[model samples]
Target: MGEKESEKLLFWEHMRTPIAPQHPTLPKLLVLLILFVSLTYLVYTLKLVSTSRACKDAPFSKTIIAVNATASAAAVLRRGSRETNPEDRTDLRHLVFGIAASAKLWDQRKSYIKLWYRARDMRGVVWLDEKVKSEENNSDTLPPVRISGDTARFKYTNRQGHRSAIRISRIVSETLRLGMKDVRWFVMGDDDTVFVTENLIRVLRKYDHNELYYIGSLSESHLQNIFFSYNMAYGGGGFAISYPLAKALQKMQDRCIQRYPALYGSDDRMQACMAELGVPLTKEIGFHQYDVYGNLFGLLASHPVTPLVSLHHLDVVEPIFPNVTQVEALQRLTIPMKLDSAGLMQQSICYDKSKSWTVSVSWGFAVEIFRGVFSPREMEMPSRTFLNWYRRADYTAYAFNTRPVSRNPCQKPFVFYFSKAKYNSTMQQIVSEYERHRVPHPDCRWKMANPAAFDKVEVYKKPDPHLWDRVSSEEKLLQSEEVKGERDHGDRCGYV
Candidate 1:
């Protein structure tokens, strides 16, 4: 009874003994810590998911949008800076010329190259099919000659076209392969093409050389434009490719030319590559392909309101001047060109109300005198003294506006060709003389004024570097003053 009672009492005593409170503060703090950690993890996971979703859904957030906007603005600013920086301007040094020449024509055409080519200032190579005899002893005055890579692999199916077209089309790519440094433009031309280097630079400066530009002009013949692409830059007139574009062409040009077997000429093939690259021709009216026969007087006398960048097919057309070889004529033309390149071949018109005569002055080239008053609009249009490329084609075949050669002898322009110019240092004037081109006109019953009375015309001009800048204002002044007969007087056309 004692042992059983002791065991029961001991068990009762153990059960009745209260357990020590598990340090209530410690347990309560531990539970709170665990809940805090779990709650924090849940909240963090939800926040991470929301952020990921926002990044994926709204990719261009304000920060990202701002970055893109800044990048675009920076690009525009870079372009603007490059264009405006006078030190970064496109000049003779920035141009690399690739002339497409035949060994056969090289001798005859090197003179044309020598005219505009300032060897020390220019970076150029005349790419010929084969080495010419003259190339061995080539002068430092002329561009260095190089033999073109054989293009036997390329196929040419155009019956009317010469296979040399293939080689010519690859000129820019070959030029790029030479790895010219600091070259902004790769200008391509035929051996016969003559460039006014200053005007060429002026024309090039108008465009962004960093961008892809296939700059040139259409053929003078409308049929040529129709046959070829109206959009194609005629290589004979010469064309320029931006450095970036030439590099881009170097990537795909060989493959590109292979695709166009039936294309007629180098320009078309070059244009084909440009088309593949999604670059359209940047037609600058200054480049003259001169795809016509007969006298160039009508064309040159009334040059469009742009710089005369180039002239091609000089051999095909009559000598520009009345009585000289083409080379001599160009040499003579350089006189006024040196004095004022921008004003070269730029036409200015005024009236002599006393004589009821109209005077059109082709600065640096020629002067035309009409007995009757002619609108500036009519005077601006070239007279069709030059024939179209095709003998069968009519005056309407020209790409530009052309007035008919007047059947009435009296209505014909009494021409005065540019002779000599002297720069008077004291006066700061370029005094130029233009002699009468004596083409005897039949006597007309109607008498207005006699242009033949003058043996020579003297033009007094101030050497204006900013001639083109004032063109608009001068034109406006001409319009305003012509009606009042206060712009120009007989035998003396004052600057309006």
Candidate 2:
């Protein structure tokens, strides 16, 4: 029991074990070191797991849904931006429509409106003059409007060509006063104007109602556009106002109308009012004002960079889709067709990677990429099929800087071929053509430039430097004539 005896006992135990007694301090240090290292490793592992989760949470932002996808198409085409999902959209309930029509056209508007509007959750009111009011019997969607001025005329006065457009202020003022408390946007368009609701919803989400925003695109008609204020949101093609801006307009609308007596049209008047409020026109590409007269074959065939929103003046123009009628185009628009963003935007021209079929808006210019993956055989007399690589179109030889690949019209793929010159076709017609053909895959690359760019754009023969190069236009048959030889051409030619 003495200290010497205890020491002697410890030595004997160590000797028996054949191991030195570990330092008491060393044991504590070793335990602490192990705990520290384990904690550091665990913290590092947790950090890596958090980063991976964040990437998974976001597939794509809803705001740039189609845009990013379309950009992806550009990348894939330019070997850049690739357009993905066909039917990505936000809430339609937040958007409301306002269709301005003549009394005579009220009945015509009702049919399509009734057909398409209900399914998409669209809420709208029809504005008609007193004459139409007298003519209309149903009176359900057509609200009774009371204009401040008497004797509304197509010609507001001899000096003004405003037609009934002079009534725009009152119409918008009334629409806001109608007490639509639910929706965030108030979209304005003519009765003849047709819209793609899914695209419309996506477009509306890009803006904020908290700001005073007026969104639309310019009229496609160069003359009409020049005659009118370039800053205006051409009413016929369709335009939208955020809830806050509409409320802002309502406050001074009466006075604003009184101030703009000399304004020639409703759009200009609206622009003037917006200017007073310091609101600028926010231009979007999807809206179309068919101010031009003629077939929109080339324009629709090329397809646009953005989603198709509205198309106006359906009566004057032929259907832009390859081979379809107006009535059929109207029907296809109401429901969801198995199409992607580019297809849904109503492009007349598209290339199916799956089918390799390239259809154009021209009368009968539909061609398929008939190259088989396994065979890679050339047919002296081929049926329908295109080269699979074209199923993934490489570069759209645009007429810009000839900079290999870019959606930038001025910068690259300098062989601008698609026409930006005009658009007369309704968005529906383009959709109809694609639904039947479904030409291009959503991810396939497309080159849209001035149609003039295609002047010498024939795919060059093999063993020729002109392959996909700019060549003389003299020997080449035009796209119109090519339609006639499409079947024969498919047998002979490998290029689009």
Candidate 3:
């Protein structure tokens, strides 16, 4: 055969019968193995992703810092344990505090840090739109400046109105995404609010962080409660969201915010969002939004038996404690509270029909005891008198309410002021001394007709500065009249 024809025949022969010299199946088998492994990994990743989605909605476990975690506690029974690696009760971590500070007032966090922030053993982080760059090197601008203010657009949005809600929602997302997986309770508060960390933890201990808890107090004023639902916790007093709820909020908040564009306040917007999730405010009396401006003795004197968690509206009111500024009050609260004074001032308002007295105890004021228990048809100023030895013996030496009647200054007849008694003091002890007396007998009234002048009898007067001398003198005159009548009644009652 010719050479070319022979070469063609050899090529055809080689193509027809593949070489058995090497294993051709090896590379194909390797590719198949690689594909199989890749498929298995992809399935595993999808399962993990699905689990994480469900976990975001599942109830999460929490621990209190310094408070021991008990593994024996009943685990939160969730519906979908089908997760290959479910989070068990074995996952216990400390109480976590996530403070979402607005861009405008991040600097003012000093009060919180110095007061209650450092005392807590739990985890905490102040989430801000962006960290502040020190401007000490830059000349102080000719323009006025606040301690915690900036002009950045992002900062303003994070600190302002309904837009701030977006900031909070994002903080929750970022906080969890960046690995706060162990955080159980996420506490949210403003720049001015002061929390009693131990009391906060104590209060939180009462509830399971695993369950949904939107805990806080309502506004003290009816007008505020009218504007903001009493069902919502006033953010000034601060509020807590369970880890699960916070995560759930992270997912639902943006959509919720879109639904409520009219809500301009961060707190109210959050309330609306939580409402969408069917979570109502768990009213706790210990959280106080001292939304008033004046002495707190009157109200704090009557605090209830619950732990005091927070005090809001810092500089809005001064002298929250007797003779002390808001900062001073914050400092004082950090000191251990006497067990007897755990809950001093409660949100108490009651009218005694038998005695015809309308008594009320507020956060920063003394117990207001009014003679006519009935609500006024219209606002009326009943004549008011403030003079009694009892007044000298309270948390304050004198004034129970510095700004009584607010700026309106409502006066009532025989208005008696007394220092706050112990929280556990009986109703009898709490009432003003004049209130303790019943109507005088006819004979006693007649005898008091010859009411002696102050010069004629021994009397005690609260020492006052020249600014208060005139007012104090007038009060003394009222005291003289009331004393004589009381003396006549005492004689009639067989007292010496």
Measured by lDDT, the strongest candidate is 1
- Writing each residue's lDDT as its tens digit, candidate 2 over 249-312 gives 8898767767766778788888888999999999987787755444543344333546677777
**What does candidate 1's lDDT look like per residue over 1-496, in tens digits?**
6899989989999998999865568889999999999999999999999877846756568668767767866765775687589788677999999998988877788899888888889999999898667654456678878888899999999998799899989999888898878999999998899899888987887678889999999998999999998999899999999999999999999999889999888889998899999999998999989999989888888899788899999999888987789999999988888888887888878777777888888987898888888877888899888789897538779888999888887888888889999899998988888988998788977756688888888888777665443324446687557644543444457421
lDDT of each: 0.85, 0.53, 0.51
What are the per-residue Cα lDDT tens digits for candidate 3 across 272-327? 88889999999887787655444444345445446667877666655444445657
Please give the lDDT score at residue 76 for candidate 3: 16
Could you tell me every candidate's TM-score relative to the true structure? 0.80, 0.52, 0.48
- Rank by lDDT, highest first: 1, 2, 3
Candidate topping TM-score: 1
Off by over 4 Å in 2: 1-90, 131-163, 321-325, 333-342, 346-496
Better of 2 and 3 by TM-score: 2
Candidate 3: residue 241 lDDT (0-100): 78
